[model samples]
Target: MTRSYDEWKAAAAAMEFDGRPVIGGVRVAARSGETIAKTNPATGEVVSQIHACGQEDVDAAVAAARAAYEAGEWSRAGAGFRRERLLAFAGLIEEHADELALFDSLDMGKPVREAAAIDAPGSAALYRFYGEAIEKAEDLIPVTPPGSTALVTREALGVVAVIVAWNYPLEIATWKLAPALAAGNSVVVKPPVEASHSTLLLAELAIRAGIPAGVLNVVTGRGSAVGRSLALHEDVDMLAFTGSTEVAKQLQQYAGQSNMKRLALEAGGKSSNLIFADCDDLRLAAQKAAFGSFYNQGEVCSANSRIFVERSVYPEFLELYAEAARAYAPGDPLDPETGIGALVSEAHADTVWATIERARRDGTIAAGGTRPEINGSRAFIEPTIVTDVPADHEVHTREIFGPVAVVAPFDSEDEAVARANETPYGLAASLWTGSLARAHRVSQRLVAGTVSVNTVDALGFTTPFGGFKQSGFGRDLSVHALENYTDYKTTWMQWG
Candidate 1:
């Protein structure tokens, strides 16, 4: 149930937040005794002081994760044991769903309604999905030559470090944590300094759910500090990251420079949404286009920021799309009725506004391109749509990571696919069409990890989620996600 604005305000007023780093299963002050103020983007108020972890803090978290792994309390536990505990963790998350939702909503200015209804429940569902998958996993016994036997098994990698973006704090963290923990790997999580409250709360809940002490630790700080340290730490066995493409490259280089630890990265994306003239439901398509480009204020990695409409329907679709986009006007994140919330920070809003200004010079603003002050904070940007964007314009090629989309007309299906594939990112794509053959043909040719026939950014726990090219490799969901945390082992015996 969605709470009233006043109720949400009262809850925020009553809530007390602690942003200290969680090391060895307990909240601890940073050794450096330094902290960064976490400002609420919605209200321009300081929410709490988050720890600024340095190298020493990263070392301590890694040591604790390693100790937990070597202790074999969680690492050596049976699949059933892990499954049961993970289920309990999932239950705990559901029990505290409101608190988790509030944490992300307050920390990062996500709409409380969406954060409560989508992210929190979705996070719990991921835990449950991965927990159920644990017991279903089966070892392989390959055929062997006479007098010989071979057994293949999957084993957990020790001390995995997870770094997630601030956009979808608890959800993204859970995407990595559920599989890593279910696979029996002790983990150290590095949440973005912009939004670490929810992650800290998640770790506390993990402990309460009977997870082994030190099994899951959260280090909250700037990415350059805690994040980079985790990437370079020699003790870390594996690292999973969700962030910018440039950061992914840096993490890869850091891994090479240090321990050469295993890395699974889900990086940046400028996904495309192609609307063919044959689409039967233009109005529905336009609504989805708005949602694709504006959901989560377009802070999503796979947001369809590039829209290619068929020339025949371009004018009509553009108008409908603009009308749809206007529905996402930014408002108080705490208000359940608000569809759009503030950006992650004033700094991020400035960056987006700069992009909008550039887009106005090079492209036509079809929908929204304004930032209105809310609660004395100008961190709220309207859902913006830009049309007539030059093919080579910066807004057309670069990722703004905001509720801004660029629209253009394509003459043919081939042209649409070609232009869409021209991007450096291959994370996701969406194409609206009525012909089954064209759908299959175009979907096959799209240079994206996931292609949606009539939807945008289609994903589920049952399907693998990842990307190609600079969007980085390694899957995030489905049974394939387990591969991120586990390594295969083989045992052979021969008697002659």
Candidate 2:
């Protein structure tokens, strides 16, 4: 709120961005000497040339991470020491919040207002939460036979490789990095090609906050090169990734082909929001439905892109939802008052527009679906709502990964649940009902990882965030996420 749109735009025009790879706690050039043009989604301008990593760069990063893990500088450090350093890292993130916010806005077209207010602060809070939680991890002593002792302790899995999606670049990275680092594991992060600025800056900040050299490294490039190398590298003990389901499956195959490295994946979703006629407030439900579907330009993994309304409320809810969806008009990312920002790239915007066009052919366009020109870039698509979609249509099952909502009507509670669970993804689902019994009943039957009653994409650091079935296994947040970066070791002693 401090900066006007003009002021923010001016700051971006004069901003100096460093897109060099960060390895072994320092800014390093790619061994391949290749680079990719980093484009600003808002203005369609080449902002910087980011170093593109090859297999050689991946090897260097892996070797450095393995060395750091085996050297006992961070992995074997005392919990209190790691905790203090992580807390300091969190503080530095807060200190440089504005700069990092600008990185997200300019790098991937995230609204600077949203990035600064939510993503940056949220990333800092995650680090702080994990920093405080690390020391609280307790070893277990189990009851054993007489004259025998057994103790189980949690230990780090060395050299964890993280590959994150472009949307919410810093926040999603933190979701994996905080718990991995908190568990005392050395990490190598491969940021999405479309948005690497914030992640590179984050790695630099980790070094500044006293994380040891080689403990955290960032390799920036296409997923085909850098991500594939990490996934197949025998030296990597684990891979934590958040991206497409297709990519997640590929990573799984690569893991099996190599060393069978552990994989923690939070993949794609075609989540649904079920609105019943008996809801306490239909208007509130419609607003939340629109927010859940269009927030972050609807690039979220757990976005409620599919909405199922009861037959009695379908007509009324669809209108309210369409009205709410149209409120999120695409605008300049640096604008403090703008709710919706540009898509990550013109290519991605085109893809989303194509999806909208298909939806129009397959169904009815309830609200916005036009690709409006913004800031001289063709990457802006207004929030769209599609209604009267068939049950077996591809639009209902596919992950659009854009600000497009599909609405359908169901007659009974059983019918609503059935339609909602018809998708291949089981990442998240939400329901709105006035009856407490109905809420619990429908929630129990929803085949999703997280079920929010009368809410959308409900999550926190205290709760585990992940999916079921093809949405990918393993949790990301909470104490469970720390476990993903670690394993348990049990020791037994017998003496008579």
Candidate 3:
């Protein structure tokens, strides 16, 4: 909060992508010697030139990771050492939080203050949580016949390749990286090419935190090149990814076609905000629902794009939601007063509006449907509210991944639950009501990985986050995510 816009500008101007690519604990250039331009989504200006890696780079990274794993350097350092090292990494993340936050904002066009408050610190917190988790974890004692003793222990999956999306670059990647490393697996992180600066900086910080070289590697490029190669690499023992459903499916296919590597995916979501008739604090519920739908310019995978309000309160809730939306008028991300930052990229912004345009054909635009006047192409969309949307409309059923939402009404509790579950995605949902019995009953009925009662977008360090159905499987966050990076091996011995 103390840093000014000039400070952020200076930091961005001085950033050096000169590290190229880090492999085996050293910075190296890609075999192809290729580079990709990362642009600020707000200004459409080149932020940095990141070394683009293809099949060759992926091969080298995976090889390095495999060698590191087999060397028993990080993996065999034992849980206590890993814990200390991970904590050190977390400390560095905190130490450089301001710069890292600026990197995220400048690279992806998130509001600087928002990025600082949420993404940067959250990443550090995740690392710290995983760091402590490894210390308390224990091997299991198994039941056995009287003459035998059996012990089951979890072992790291050699090399984990993580692919994350452009939105929430640092936060989401940390969700995958923390547990993977904590479980003693080496990793090759492929952050979304459009926003790689912060991730690249993060990798450098990891080394400073004392993670051995090759223990954590970052390869930046199009998903088609680096991501495809890494996912299809046989030496990679596991793949953990957070991105679009289509891409997640592709990764699974790569794994199946290659080594059948273990996969943990947290993909797309068309989540719902279900407001009941007896909702507590109607104004706050509406406001939170709006925030849930449009935060981060609505770039969240779990954005509550589909809002179902009880028929009795739908109109009032809609009005309050519209009021909240208006407050988030799009503006320059670097401006401290600005609320709605630019969309991640001009291309993605176009895709978001295209979905909104399609929704207009069959839905009513309640508020803020038009594009804002911004410097860059498709840089921002006014926080939008759509109503009278059919249950099966694209806006209702698909993930817009922008500052857009569709509000509809439901008559009964069963109807509300039914409407919420109608979509193929069941990632996250929120229920607002004062009735304890109804909350429990409806929560169970709604088919989603995470459910919030009397709240919206309720997520943190302690719990698992994921989805059901086409939204993808497995979880992120929490110690629960550690399961993806390790497998249990049981040993049985006969005693004299």
Models 1 onward score TM values of: 0.99, 0.99, 0.97
State the lDDT at 300 in candidate 2: 92
CA lDDT of each prediction against the hidden true structure: 0.93, 0.92, 0.86
Tens-place lDDT digits, model 1, residues 1-496: 6689999889888878998999999999999999899899999899899989999999999899989999999999998899998999999999889898888999999998898898999999999999999889999999999999999999999999999899999999999999999999999999989889889999999999999989999998899888889998999999999999999999999999999999999999999999999998999999999999999999999999999999999999999999898778899999988979999998999999999998899778888989999999989999998887789887778989999999999998889999999989999999999999999999999999999998888999999999999999999999999999999999998996
- The deviation in Å at residue 445 for candidate 1 is 0.8
Worst 10 residues of 2 by lDDT: 386-395
**Local error of candidate 3 at 409, Å?**
1.4
Candidate 3 lDDT over 148-207, as tens digits, reads 998999899899999988889888889999999999999999988877777788888888
Query: Can you write out model 2's per-residue Cα lDDT over 1-496, one digit (the tens) per residue?
Result: 4788899889888889887889888899998888999999989899999898999999999999999999998999998999999999999999988888999889899899999989999999999899999999899999999999999999999999999899989999999999999999999999988889889989989988999999999998999999999999999999999999999999999999999999999999999999998999999999999899999999999999989999898999988898888768889999998879999999999999998998899888889889999879999999988887787776687898889888888889999999889988899999999999999999999999999998999999999999998999999889999989999999999995
Better lDDT candidate (1, 2): 1
User: How far in Å is the alpha carbon of 235 misplaced in model 1?
Assistant: 0.8
Candidate 3 scores a C-alpha RMSD against the true structure in Å of: 1.4
Better of 1 and 3 by lDDT: 1
Each candidate structure's count of clashing pairs = 0, 0, 0
Best by lDDT: 1
